[model samples]
Target: MMRAILPTRALVPIAGLWRVTACMAGAALFLSACGATTGGPGVTPGPASPVVGAPPEPAVLGVEMSPERLAFTPPHLEGMDLVRVGVLLPFSGASAALRSEAGHLLRAAELALFERGIENVVLLPKDTEGTARGAEAAAEAAIADGADMIIGPLLAAEVRAVSGPARRSNIPVISFSTDTSVAGGGVYLLSFPPEEEVRRVVSYTAALGADRFAIVAPATPYGQLVSQAYRSAAAEFGGTVTAEEVYSGGVDSMSQAARRLARAGIGSLEVGRALAMTGEDWRPTDSGAFQVVMLPAGGDDLRMLAPSMLFADIDPLLVKFVGTGLWRNPDSAREPALANGWFAGPDAEMRARFETAYEIAFSEQPSRLAGLGYDAASLAVVMAASEGGIDRAVIEDPNGFLGVDGLFRLRADGTVERGLALYTIRRGQFEVLDPAPVRFGPDSMAVDVEPGES
Candidate 1:
């Protein structure tokens, strides 16, 4: 049992522990819950600062149960604590439309744990109907089944529903959704979301000293939001939006949109990147006016639009391409012609190694998504086995980087801190041009230079 170390307000850093001044304990039962051993980070929370309280303002309302206090209790059945690891995914929904990618990943993840000699790892799998409600149902069912932990609900909204219930149950969640918004108590997302991808991309592209960028995406909100995120993040680093393009329904129908660029005289986003390489505070007014093209889509879509873009007299390489984690797939980098395209993702060799281990165990190549599954399950097992599983010190353990996802930490918010690598394709393979970085909230981190940055 963790002794609630509640420190009064105005207390200075008393030997470095986080102090929380609160009304003395009045433990009235709101809900009858069983007690279990509590454990996690024993690290010190940063020092507190004073806040003025003169003016009356709206008070922040909170839910009944504070998610942070929730603890994960492993069930010991027959002498061994058989962790009921629940995997909630859409194995039969629209995800099936993606050719059983989810199932392949799921199996591979389980197999990885099994190979590690962690035999008592009981697998509890459930299928959501590829909808928010389905995801919620799956999560609730998992909790009802005595699952000590929940693995995934793949989508963002699904994560939202899963988070609350998991928190209420004090069950820690390791999700595959990349949406940062889904992160909170009991939820730890591993999907390389747009924000993480964008941050790495902007950091890499910024080093070129070119401050102008052009972005394009489908007409959907997802597309607009990603584009907007890139633009806003780009300017925060002193960059400029010289040109922007919007297409409808993925890059497959972006041919007409490609032509629109010729009129913009934007030349290529690649040129802008090259300008940034000058290592100066070059703005849109600094040199070649404006030129850049950033497409938020996959390599297949990138390929389809290539011919049209080229036929329109647009130099493909001249317009250096910038992309998100979706481009992390080997197939995405296989266009061969996309050798110059820049994207943020896991290290290729790291993925190759994981795939080798997976294939040896399962007799087949693991899906790309499996990497996330492996990281999530493996981390949970290790964390649970630790003296303090979800404690702030453990979650913030400086060394607890999720190897598969590049680098991430379990933050106090119960959300994860992500940092994916910045890679460029060369000779049909992704070469690590820059090391990954920690995602600083919603802001873009400054790009680091390697020994031979050109």
Candidate 2:
């Protein structure tokens, strides 16, 4: 198959999440895990055939990928008899695949390393049972066993649980969790976080020429956080959110909620629920749909909103439809009532890979939860090869943009900042409407709020 996108010198910074089309470099990119070669002891990865089209396994020598700028500067693993690495995943949780996938990640990482002849590392696997307390115990066990570093504790709570111990022991824990708040001086999150999505949405919408915006939000924690990020990122692009509407509705009163938005000349749950019963005309402004609509809930309401936006021909292009990462699937674009539009979330590449890997490994594609497993494991390998004795260039540089599910950078705080690509449902496919990892520098006016500031 394919080789690491080729070891490069340094990344060439790209501008705007939506403006990039390709990764061009000789000094800064390794687009694949194939073509990998090593000169030391390496762990052989297990079978990893994609259900659809996963790139064939790479040559095995036990070499792993290094983060940008930093490299897999082999931290004395070569002639050291055996290098002990820990694997912490939930084996008995509701989602069995997450736990099992840890093994797959180990396989993948080991294969990536095997080709490099770096075979001295041994994985000390443990189960977190999918809880914070469980993760804490597993992490302690790994450290007690002289594990060089730990990977996993997929859940955010678990990431938080294990961080304290990792910090105390200086045994770097590369987490698959995305709770950016869990980040500390020692814990590292490899999962793409919400911040990257925020950056991607704002930068892309600006590139699409959206000058004004608004958000339709819910009064929940997740809803409020995304809304705030959307609002802030929108401002970074010279755009203004003129309105923010909220709904904390139940099924019994869903219609009444829709009616309220109708009265305000805004699309509301009140009006949406009553569109048919009372024959209330659902009207969008002649200027088109509000510049943007940030929908926060899922499971059912989206089916209702789709038709409303359609019959109104709200011009999704005129009014970009912003949705939570929860809305990244066929249902959002299906129902025959909705129009092709834009949204931000787990994005396309993730959709493509997870679907195939899940089926091959477990006869099913993973849901959002499964994503955490993949993110955590992939990130752990990256972090292990970087800051905590496993120096790799890809995970150490500020200018690097990893194109797995999203782009990310190892911030000084031991947490990662994600950079997701933007997608628009075009024709029948989710097209990469906006390329990601828009480089923001000291000069860029992006606001730098402290992590966990909320």
Cα lDDT tens digits for candidate 1, 27-78? 1111113322221111111124422232111111111222243322222223
lDDT computed for candidate 2: 0.51
Task: Show model 1 residue runs off by greater than 4 Å.
Answer: 1-77, 92-99, 119-121, 129-134, 249-256, 266-285, 289-291, 311-319, 328-339, 390-393, 396-399, 413-416, 435-454
Best by TM-score, which number? 1
Q: Write the per-residue lDDT of candidate 2 for residues 128-213, one digit (tens) a residue.
A: 76778877776666666456667677778988888887788776777777677887666777665665566566666577566566
Q: Model 2, which residues run further than 4 Å from truth?
A: 1-82, 94-118, 249-259, 262-289, 308-318, 345-388, 391-396, 401-403, 437-454
**Residues forming the 10-long window of minimal summed lDDT in candidate 2:** 17-26
| Residue 53's lDDT in candidate 2 | 29
How well does model 1 score by local distance difference test?
0.56
Judge candidate 2 at residue 130 and give its lDDT: 79
